[model samples]
Target: MYCFTDPWYLPVDLKLIKSIFQKDFSYFNDHGMYCHPKDNISMNLFNLVNEDWKNLRAKLTPLFSSSKLKSMFQIFVDKAEVLEEVIGSYSSRNEPLNIEDVASRFTIDVITSCGFGIETNALKNSNKEFMKCGVETFNPRLLKFVLMEVVPSGILANLGFKANGAHTNNLFNNLISEVIQYRETNKVFRNDFLQLLLELKQNQEMTDDQIIAQCFGFFAAGFETTSITVMFAMLELALNQEIQNKLRDKIEEVLEKYDGNVCYDAVMEMNYLDKVLNETLRKYPPGPIIPRNCTKTYRVPETDVIIEKGTRVIIPIWGLHRDPEFYPDPEQFNPENFNAENKANRPDMAFIPFGEGPRMCIGLRFGLLETKLALIKLLKNFKYTLNGRTKVPIEIDPEAIFTLKIKEDVWLDVTKI
Candidate 1:
């Protein structure tokens, strides 16, 4: 079948998937997740389409460049330390550590530190107000999720509907606005993403709501993507002890060069960590499906199949990531699958944990750096094993069909080494 009877269309051929992402770029600029002007909180990069997306994304892109990442590396290093101290307590209690919970805490602080100039210390203080808002932001409402993802956003906006509640939206708006204002008034400058966004505001083209949307957008995309990636990576490590030990050994050797500091330089040098993260993303990609709206009529290259404009395309990233033909023994959690020689042996598009194309996640670089740094700190200081509370042979939450969300806590017994 060239198309499905449902509202979505599937590009059955892998080449068509690439075509949608990169080859026929003009035809599919939007990811199809919608936003409305009525809900300023709903107006984020992930939901934007066409010109609005292009304009806003252009302003934010340069800030995430390589040089900029280097300037912000220390903030991530500090959070890694907090992760160690926080998780250490769980080890001392001899309690089964819920990695899903702990990992969320780590990413929350990362978002606060990176998005705002101040550290909310979410990992250290669980009851911080920002923590509550952060949770409310990510744990999206069921109806809102359907409306934002399934229904046309213009219709919802026309009917006076929004993706987030006013109370929750106000909290984020007030928090980010206050932080930026305080920074400007006090001449408090920080080498972080927030500073970059603040600088963009000087252009006179960026508005407070746009800035707020971007800050919240970082959390929306970064929070679950980074945290869940870590959770799945840890879960895999717990089940595959041999692979875990090998990675730990590599971490120890590298940290010694940095005097045991989990610095950007040190983490980047750890080739094994990259392999491990690559493998985890392969088995359980953060965004399982790449959703895109066909903005113009297009025909598949070398085929007569025509996809009409305004059609929604679902790129089955999860299916492609696990295709046995591309990845031999696709079910196993093996880091060697990402080994230099092995990776080169496979097609480049086959391993797109981050969606392929101009609209692909730019924050993926920061996500990878943060995740690898977290693993570096954890593995170097402690050891983990599967706890009784965890379900064996893991499964994703049905509700989290778009993103990989485990139904149960990926509880692990942590032992300080």
Candidate 2:
């Protein structure tokens, strides 16, 4: 069923997805995600294709090397500690906490420091410039996203149709350009993402727009996805007490190995914790849909139903993750599904929270490790359970663009362990 179709906008099955991503990839290389080299030069990686994307990916890959992420442990720990303090205040008062709000702010701080080499302290100061810009760009209203996703560029351009809410976009681009200028002028060096992007702009003739585009891409891809994953992980922990305790035990056991400190190695060592995170993403993936449009005419093999040029194709990652064939008792949250032995046996493309192919999320390591550290700190200091203030069944905001978020809030009660 077509997603934009009237009534129910469900997803297509996996067979169709494999053809698009794998077997017939040549025909579907261009995702046609919103792009404007003139107006939205900051919209880079998501739209660029062929040589442009390939060259940039090559230059950017080494910066995100695992060793680079390992060097970022201090940033993760510092931000996670801030989050813990905020949660500590709530736990002390026996207050019912809307944890997602806290998690969103925590991720904002993490993304800010990592993405721009700036510490936002968003939890303490709600109006941080970087955090405000990030929210504005990513979680646009549903109708807006749909128009951008479905409506042709010709229509938008002819009608002078601009997406609502450019305040953040303008603010962020200005901040990034200023930061880049400051860094270049002073010869300032940092191991964070901004430093790497600066290296690109200097070494590669990547225009200011390209530089800003990469920064915006990281901000869009990093913050919301990590926050959603963190909230879902917490929700599962609150609902499934035994699993929560087990995960906590794994986190504690690993941290004990590293002198009660959460580091990259300690996080990686928590295999069970990894499985839990994977399972959480499987059930409540932040990016539920990956939409791509055919850049040129293509043929669907075996069937004579050739998809004409410029047809819109939607890949329902959410449906595939929930498919009963791939995961028996799909609704049950079982970490064992991602266990080493089981994961080895699963199909290559079966798990795609981050999507597949050459265009997989560039900031995945930073995003995942940040979330892991936050969860470790929270689980170590506090134990949480669902509070009565929480909506009984989570209701997704049909308005928000990417995240599978609730219109109300996800509330939880916590006690100091």
Candidate 3:
């Protein structure tokens, strides 16, 4: 497929997709997204290419390790508690809850506290500065998005254009600068992502700009993806009452083993919860398309097709996820699709909601944990049903460029169980 003058290839075969993503990764390692050299914020891990990406990925991988995520579990729990209170207020009045909005607030609070080491309290106060920044960052502007994609970063930089707006960049810069200075000066250290970046800085492994960029990346990546996942999962559960009740029962059953606490170990024990989330991801993958740039000329295996250097490749994840060949009754919301027996029947690469290979999202564990914790809190305490305001057969927002989002608000009538 060619979009304008750019040649793009959409590989539908699982083996070829695997080769592109994993076996022959060196041939297509970059996302080919625009990143202006002058835009320091754009130089974060998600945008950095080749060697820079390798170095930054190596430095940041450990920060999301299981042990590190476990240490940060309490932050998720605290924010979820606040979420419960907020949702409780709506449920008490029998009001239709705009769940997407609430979910976004919950994730904003969790990400800011864990990633930036600041308590924005977005869950309680919707007008928090961090909340505003998050909304602005993701609210897609068609012109800016198209410009960033088609125009070369250098040309855009020469034209004095930034990928992100000046306001967003400045807010993150000033906030990060103040936090770093205060922490270093006062010898205040906390067990958070920012603290880990500071340690890297102390060891000369990362620069201050690198630290800020990575933190901004953390917020940008973690905030919306996880929140939308929660929103969609809740919407699906609301639509399917039996599955919702079964999942809630399983959640309660698992918590009893650990004296009714949503601890790291307890969350880990909820296998059914994992299946539900996996199915949710399959139906509504946050990142529906995987884009790659051919870094080296390569030949298709057992074929004469030659992939030229600088060509773009697109993996249609949404198509693959919903393909009836891989998943029977593809549109049905069935957690059984992720059951061990069912999973064994499909290709490993067929269900990549968080992507696959080395370039897979680094915040996979962090995002999953926060989402699961929120579900556990919400499901165990309340029951939800699709409100009349929520249109059936939800429509995807055409303006959403990066992540999967619906045009209508996901409104649900909540009831205290």
* Candidate with best TM-score: 3
Ranking by lDDT: 3, 1, 2
Error of 2 at 381 (Å): 1.5
The per-prediction CA RMSD against the true structure, in angstroms, equals 2.2, 2.7, 1.2
Pick the winner on lDDT between candidates 2 and 3: 3
lDDT score, residue 94, model 1? Answer: 89
Q: Mind giving the per-residue lDDT tens digits that candidate 2 earns over 1-417?
A: 445652222225456667777777766776666665544543567667767777878878887888888887898899889888988999989898887778888988887787788777887776456556656666776777788767866676566554425676676678888988889899999878788877767776576777887877777777878988999899888989999999988888888889996767778899988889899989988888776667667666566666767676666788889888789888888999998788887776678888776767777777788888888888997999999888767777776655577777789999998
**Candidate 1, 195-312: lDDT as tens digits:** 8887888878788888888887887788878988999999999999999999999988998999987777888899999999999999999888888888999887887878788788
Q: lDDT per prediction? A: 0.82, 0.77, 0.89
Candidate 3's TM-score reads 0.98
Residue 185, candidate 3: alpha-carbon lDDT: 96
Per-candidate clash tally: 0, 1, 0
lDDT of 3 by residue, 1-417 (tens): 997787898899999999998999999889887775688888888888999999889999999999999889899999999999999999888798998889989998899899979888878878467666666667649888778768778889888786767777888999999999999999998989999999999999988888989988999889989989999999999999999999999999999999997888899999999999999999999988988889999999999999999998998999999999999899999999989899999987899887778898999999999999999988989999999988989999878877888998989999998
In candidate 3, the residue pairs with backbone N, CA or C atoms under 3 Å apart (3 or more residues apart, or in different chains) clash, namely: none
What's the lDDT for candidate 2? 0.77
Residue pairs of candidate 1 with colliding backbone atoms:
none
Question: Model 3 lDDT vs. the true structure?
Answer: 0.89
| Preferred candidate (TM-score higher): 1 or 3 | 3
lDDT score for candidate 1 against the true structure: 0.82
